[model samples]
Target: MFFLKIRSIGCAILLSICGQSAWAFHKDVYEPRVPNEILAQEQQVKSPHPVTPERIEAGRRVYFGVGFCVTCHSKDGTGVNLPGHPPRDFTDAKWQKLRTDGELMWVLKNGSPGTGMPIRVGTDITEEDGWNVIQFIRTFGGK
Candidate 1:
């Protein structure tokens, strides 16, 4: 009889801990909106630099090297789900289809605020390199 009571109490404690953690992950976090002007722009606006084999290769290097994209987005761009946040999967065909080159570049340059993505403007990647990275990410969905 005493063992049953102790077990019940332990179960209740475990349930409460799990419930708290679940709630934390679902909590609404405020993310700023991207400007409509930029979002509405055409493909040209997104990637001013022309895409070439060399550019894509350069971007690949950045992804694995300096950009450190593999750390979060993973080598295949399938992304890794952290404790409370899930990384964006670049390999999703539907998701990739909907996004424009400009949007991708914008995200790379400014980074997705309120998320794990950091602003690259002040980082080691230059504007040209950012464009190159965009070129590489486009290949994630297999054009």
Candidate 2:
């Protein structure tokens, strides 16, 4: 009876692994896009700071410093680790092409669901800083 229970547990674990593998391989049907309201907000909401070289530099500082983005996204923004699906590679041409600055801002303001990224909106990150970080991310891989 004990052996049978062990076998059952092993089977359950195998099924769980298989399920997660299937999900990882499964292609997403829904394409991610920023809503019009969010896009409009980017334009309507004036940043206290301008997108100057200094602002970009400041944004870079935040990305590596207080923001702690490098912990996952990596110093180069090329992503790190591959065991459990690596973080998004900001260097990807296709990804850069598909995503907009507003979309990036939206992700910053509201963390990506099911991701390790924490909600940074009301946190230490301010709206202007968020926009600045977006500007910094834009320069990733020379995009």
Candidate 3:
């Protein structure tokens, strides 16, 4: 009878601890921690979807095939780790919110210099293909 009571008490304590932890934690969505004053100074811009079905498809093929986007961007374009650069969470709307279309276009066209991402397939890739790939990238959203 004493053993049963001890076991019951232990189980209740475990459940309580688990319950507290579950409630306290949440997956942090990607939002740039920019100051409100800076945000106020910045201009708002929208990224127009410049991709067509055919181009987007071609880009997808390139991304999954020769472009080797899967290595860094992951198979789903989630932006996995390589070395120096922290992978961009494509699903993060907050991260996406910070970049303009032009900025993203430029990054796609000329890969970031300091980061592990280098100019590779994009040099040969047409502008239309880049746009398509960017559009495809935009689709990954947090559920």
What TM-score quantifies how close candidate 1 is to the native fold?
Answer: 0.70
Give the alpha carbon lDDT tens digit for every residue of 1-143 in model 1.
Answer: 99999999999889867765664565333222255565565444656678899999999999999988888989888887765456677887777777777777777778764456777745878888888988898898953
Better model by TM-score, 2 or 3?
A: 2
What does candidate 2's lDDT look like per residue over 36-88, in tens digits? 55566653444556679988988898889888788888988897774643567
TM-score of each: 0.70, 0.66, 0.57
Clashes of 3: 0
Give the whole-model CA lDDT for all candidates, comma-separated: 0.74, 0.70, 0.60
Which candidate number maximizes TM-score? 1
Query: How many angstroms is residue 137 displaced in model 3 relative to the true structure, after the best TM-score fit?
Result: 0.6
lDDT of 2 at 107: 72
lDDT of 3 by residue, 33-125 (tens): 223464333324234555567766776776776667767788765677544445577777777766555556666655643345556534756
Q: TM-score winner between 1 and 3, please give it.
A: 1
Candidate 1 lDDT trough over 10 residues, lowest sum? 26-35
